[model samples]
Target: MEQNWDDLRLFLAVAREESLSGAGKLLRLDPATLGRRMARLEKSLQTVLFVKSPQGYALTEAGSDLMQRAERAEQAMRAATAGVPVQSDQLTGQIRVGAPDGAANYLLPQVCAAIAAENPGLDVQIVALPRVFNLSRREADMAIGVSAPTAGRLVVQKVTDYHLHLAAAESYLAQHPEVSAVTDLQGHRMVGYIPDMIFDRELDYLADLGVGRVALASNSVSVQVRMIQQGGGIGVAHDFSLAATPGVRRILTDAVSLKRAFYLIRHADDRRNARLAAFAEALAVGLRAETARLEAATAGQAAPKA
Candidate 1:
């Protein structure tokens, strides 16, 4: 008997939706056509796959047995067809990478530039999501997240660790002379990243400091940084991001150093894809170098006042 993969697609759809009409809607087929396909699939396999009921359809024992294998096949098929070739010597394909806004803004540009330089034809899609991407569902080929992965199928690697420091505009610091230590922070106004929006663990570290009242709260770190630059109030900022922005002065470096790791995550199967592998390698190198640069800058700034 000839195996029909298309029938498996129809079978999986009905099993997932649990109703012929619902499956038809999802597959953009009419109920009658979907019913015919399911019947054909059951007949071809010589098995009763589903039992119809008032609620809809429930998978038979045989169908339940096949569901896991079928879904895995479907996922593999999707990964195989997600993109296309772009050049001769290079493996050209599109890679979807999800990361927080801070990484998207500060870290990814250098990584992207490196990928473009090495493989000009490769297309990269960067999705800036506050939460982790669903790698199992193929929502993204790779992810750069602040937290380590708890999921089983993913391959996670630590990219780097960086410090977060309390900073303010030099003018603002000059004015708030009393705000030199953790205890003094309670006397001053403060701008902070909204509770739900901070991705780094450092935010919690700061919360433990028992600092001053928040004068303003926002979800965007960029907004928090802008408010600080305009001399709104002191806020926690990554040392790397603060390097280029002038007028920001680090406050109580000894009292407020927050450190956290950045993680690079990808599905194990995707590691074989040339484009994904290349991009991951490039990203790791670029981020490490950037972290080193930031560490050096921080070290220089830590030197005693001349």
Candidate 2:
């Protein structure tokens, strides 16, 4: 019996994600279906491809060998279509973008909207969850991230620097004793990332405030912003994200401003992809403008009308 070439695609995704659920999220397939397909693929090949364990799927020797050939085939497929000329006006297909919750909540919706407007055929899917985007698994076509990747066949570019500061709702500040300095933070309730759940070092804002713990904590930045909005407690917020919230007030602005840069990342294999390249260029332009807006907003100024 001949093997199904399409199974190779599923195999590759499982190999990269090391779990059916992760691959299913990217592929939009149910886990049971993925498992059945993997089983069928394995049977057709007359060899076991993976060893399933609680941690996830581990590739067997045959699977490892197949992965090498599958990669070569993937590269060839990319090369075959690499020369297809796609003008800016003719761009189409979905582009998944991954980013931290802060960026996703405040910046990407507008940026992606502009991209979609320019290319009506393009579909932009923004993955807002704050986790490492596995581009190798097609988890996202491109990603905006707080940290530049130190390894992987990825192309990374610094987008722009933005600011963060301890902030609180006006009501919260009015009720709590005024925070006059960093040390004063210890005397009041604080909302921040759960100390142990922080996946990236850049996200450890409580430590920046010299606090050992938070009165309330969440892994999501959007949740932190919401808690602050509800007067739950003072917390670190992105200047742009907090810009539109009327009641939020920057605390210790002069004494505690932290600057961070966002990086644009894409798989090296897709570097020449016309739609991806055009979308990235548009995203960069939009991000730069947003960065300026965030800077002005943080300094108590309004961004000039575009």
Candidate 3:
């Protein structure tokens, strides 16, 4: 019995998703049917590919080895079709990108919208979550991260560097003590990421300000910005985000400034995929332009009168 390409495709999906239901969802097959097909594949190979457990499917050692080869085969198949004629700008496939809520909510919507407008056939799905995504598990085809990852067979491209500063709503600034220096932040109520839920060290914005706690905290960036907008308190906020948000103004521009960069991450194998490469370039270019365009608003808004 020989291994079939379609069977290998299904096997790869199961290995990545780690469960019948997860793989079924991605492949659009019922769990029972997927299980039956997996059983058939195992029978042909005369090996147990997965061990069932409470956590779902755990790939056997043999299965892990097979996964590597299957991935190579998948890449080869994609490369084979690279020479086929297609519209240069029109891409037709689903690409899922995961990012922390800040960029996902504020930046990506505009960047992706523009790409989709140009490539009408491209289906872009954005997953906004506070924590880092597991790219190896196929949680997303690509991810945007605040920091570059050190481990994983992944390709990382630094997208852009942006700035952040302590900010608060005009109404809050009016009622609170003036923030002329970092020392002034001591008595003010602060709103920022939940102390423990800060996903990346770079996101520990408040702590960098020498503050340890938040008067009001949420894991979501959009929520923190809303808290600032509602005059909750001063928080370190992205200048790009503050531009889109009304009523929020930056404070202590010279004293409490922060710089951060965004990185675009993809599987090591995806470098061979032409479509993904093109999409990645477009996204990176769009982000650089968008960040510059939005940060311009920061130039016009006067720092609060101290």
Candidate 4:
């Protein structure tokens, strides 16, 4: 027999609430309207689904049995709807990803290229935000964030540790001769990420260095890197950002080593979605490879000069 899903939803709400008024409030319908809909549903089914009493409404035997079946039907319907679009081993849907500006600049391009190469049908959209995106509301299919999310419903994987160091433009270093001590930072015009936008430890580090005032401040890591390249000022950046940039040079100091982990996060519910899974896997692999390359580059720079 054909059944209306809306009626089933109303029935489930009434059954769970055990009161017509309560269910109406839950569904945002007037009590009279809810009563009329329930009556019509009972007439269509030709059964007394609820017993009205002074206390409230209670589900009858038929209604209880129907409630159980309806709940299962709803679960099955949701699963079926989600599963239909995804074919096994065939990735083909758009995956929206949220990432920080630095990661987007230094890492995401290669990952997107790899995903596109592996699954031509998959579409990837990257949104670079300085703050975290809400995954519970499906703001993004996946997120690469600096902090490990404490939300229980999210599946988080620690992708890799990003190494940060101080960098200065070659021209700036040429102008101000390298002093072999950390205290020498006092004389340099320092550029930095905006205080509120920077991660906590990095901000604290800057504070501790007595460089309380910024020569230049920016929210975007790419912008910060560019400003440093143009000899705007000295700033902290991930090793990868300065690797290929011609005018930037790393400032080697023992106090400058900072590392933060990158986390791959997605809702637990969407973890099984084929497109999201494929993209996440490809992204993780690509990021790890990039991290290794950056490490090797850093090591080479640290090597003794012949």
Residues 1-306 of candidate 4 have per-residue lDDT tens digits of 568788888888778777888777757799889999989999999999999997888889999889888877765655666656644565676778899888888888877877788777778888898777777534577899888878668999999987877888878887886746667877878888777777535334467667778878887888988999999878887887767676677776476788888999987766555556767888899999987797667656743232
Candidate 2 at 31: error in angstroms? 4.2
Clash number for each model? 0, 0, 0, 0
- Summarize candidate 3's per-residue lDDT along 1-306 as a digit string, tens digits: 567799998998899898999999888899999999999999989999999887999999999889988988987887787556665668878999999998998889999999999988889999999999988777888999999999999999999999998889999988987788998888999999998887899998887778866898999999999999999998988888988888888877878778999999998867777788888999999989988888987767765454
Candidate 2 off by > 4 Å: 1-5, 30-33, 53-56, 301-306
Model 2 lDDT at residue 57: 94
| lDDT measured at residue 170 in model 1 versus the true structure, 0 to 100 | 76
lDDT against true structure, model 1: 0.76
Compared with the true structure, the alpha-carbon lDDT of candidate 3 equals 0.89
Report every candidate's CA lDDT: 0.76, 0.85, 0.89, 0.78
Expressed as tens digits, the lDDT of each residue in 168-282 for candidate 1 is: 8877876776565787777777888676666656455457777535787776666777888889988888787777567786778887788888899998776656667767888
TM-score leader: 3
User: TM-score for model 3?
Assistant: 0.93
Off by over 4 Å in 1: 1-67, 74-89, 197-202, 298-306
TM-score for each prediction?
Answer: 0.73, 0.90, 0.93, 0.70
- For model 2, how does the per-residue alpha-carbon lDDT over 47-163 read when each residue is reduced to its tens digit? 999999999999999999989988878877787787787555656888889998889988888888877897888888999987888787787889998999989999999999998
Model 1 clashing residue pairs (backbone): none
